[model samples]
Target: MKQPEIIFILRGATGAEHLALEGAVNLEARLSDPDRRRALVAGFYGFHADAEYCLAPWLEPVEGLDFAARRRLPRIGADLVALGGKPAPSRERPTVTSLGYALGLFYVLEGSSLGGRVIHKQLSHTDVDQRGLSFFDPYGDQTGAQWRAFIAVLDREHAAGRADSKEIVAGALDGFRLARMWLTE
Candidate 1:
């Protein structure tokens, strides 16, 4: 966790995007009910898919495709973030997260086997979570002592290949852009 603090200066992994996700997850868990907390997580994802940082025009190549068709969430997440679309923030839950967790999880949950799987493998190696759902939501293993290791693994992953390629990084950028729009608005 401390390692990424410096890297945050170079990129979004540890910047406002990371903070937003952490804030949302922390807030969701604090909510009065468990079910509502889960739904709030979903809305966070919905809002994140529509953020301007997504720069929909940049994703012209894979606009109609899934980040990872094999995974249920990323596949469905693709269309909801259509070109020229903005987040609706249209959920009926008692509380709404600022999309912090949603953005944070984008590191792993938003893409195809190429990048997403890298994070997924890290999560597996660390043994913190087996579900691959993510610590992005308050409902998952986002909290507690174990999360430390999970986050540490993320830092390691980011530090190793923070900017390996342009397209991969750009895809990640969209998730954060959506997160900022969802929260501040």
Candidate 2:
């Protein structure tokens, strides 16, 4: 059987995502400072709110999918308030039309929670977490299981040839690029 397009995408997008992560927000520094941490959280919330809003119509049709469960805007907002910051305005939105492209953006969004586990661990050692960690630790102990479930779906989509590789990859790349640019601002 042919390898799933998701596999190729994971392999191909790693470098680009890494570059984005490196140049994006300074995770370590932000964790140590309450003010910076609030800024980081708010920034990410704005970006995700805009992205998810654009992708909502496309993603809602996927069965067994819960957009509210996947959303972190509320948590980020709460965290910002806890830290005495207001939720900023939404950022520039991405254009998404197809399910394949929508899933591609979701790939980036869900994968972020996977990465968030690490940040969550780091934040736990600080008082900042008392403020809020809904964004970083949205799934809490269920993070791994949620990720596996999402991957299973993605893999199935690839195996069933339900998605177009070009569109998926384009969405993923666009997601990474825009997120990185947003964080740097």
Best by TM-score: 2
How far does residue 61 in candidate 1 sit from its true spot (Å)?
8.1
TM, every model: 0.33, 0.87
lDDT tens per residue, model 1, 21-137:
545554423223444433443555565444322323322233232223213335324333432223355432112122222223344333222332344445566634233134233
> Per-residue lDDT for 11 in model 1?
60
The 10-residue segment of model 1 with minimum total lDDT is 93-102
Alpha-carbon local distance difference test for all models: 0.38, 0.74
Q: How well does candidate 1 score on lDDT at residue 65?
A: 23
User: Candidate 2, after superposition: displacement of residue 12 in Å?
Assistant: 1.7
Pairs in clash, predicted candidate 2 = none
